[model samples]
Target: MDIREYRESDWNQVWTIIEKVFRAGETYAFSPEISELEARNVWIEMPKKTYVAIADDDEILGTYYIKPNQPDLGSHVCNCGYIVSESARGKGVASRLCKHSQQVAVELGFRAMQYNLVVSTNEGAIRLWIKLGFEVVGILPNAYKSKSAGYVDALVMYKELKT
Candidate 1:
């Protein structure tokens, strides 16, 4: 897979992925009925930069967004959220996106990356993140009200990007 910066033209395709991922109520914390306008704000407008992972023909198979974890005092640390199409899962898209996000964070001068509310029940993501060197720094009990399991814990994972 090839990772590249997102272009304005990519929003439609990116939304296709985002809609499916979010509506599934599995990975992200977004409401299933999240409007496109809100999605645009969250996935594109808010992020410092967004990326799309594509195939040779340039079909967007996965995507991620990176931004500062907080403004002002906490700006040195960044955060990222990722989504891989269901059809594209188990094919290394998430891994590639995470790696690309870390590299992009470094390029943007971020000292570390943190995932603030990773659902503990999301085993695949938890495993992938741990494999990518993120440590579980904290856990918020009953933080995520999963549609499937209701009130599951959320894990806070962090990785210092600079050496």
Candidate 2:
């Protein structure tokens, strides 16, 4: 699989996954009825960088976006969000994208990485993140209304990069 910078042509596939995840209301805080243009601005334009994980045939399997946790004084600590294609889940697609994103973050001169809103019910992601060396720095109570889990907490995870 290839994890590389996102291209304009990648938006269609990326949007497919984004729409599904957002509509599911299981993780992201985005409204289920979020429109394409809004999604584009948030996922593409707002980020410092975006990436897609592709198969050998160039089929997009997963995607991630990295940006500043906050602008100016806090920009050195980067932030990220990820979504894996439905068919690609459980195959380590998200894991690879995450690991790759850290390197990319470092290359982009970020000194740390932070996941500001990891839904508490997403155990697989929390587990993988811990395995990758991120710590749960804080928990926002009743932060996300997950479809299946109802009102759930959100974890704020942080990882200091080696610079």
Model number with the top lDDT: 2
Give the per-residue lDDT digits (tens) of candidate 2, residues 23-78: 88898999989999999999999999999999998899999999999999999999
Candidate 1 lDDT trough over 10 residues, lowest sum: 20-29
Per-candidate clash tally: 0, 0
- Tell me how candidate 2 scores on lDDT: 0.94
TM-score of 2: 0.97
lDDT of 1 by residue, 114-157 (tens): 99999999999999999999999999999988878988999999
TM-score of each: 0.97, 0.97
After superposition, the stretches of candidate 1 with alpha carbons farther than 4 Å from their true spots are none
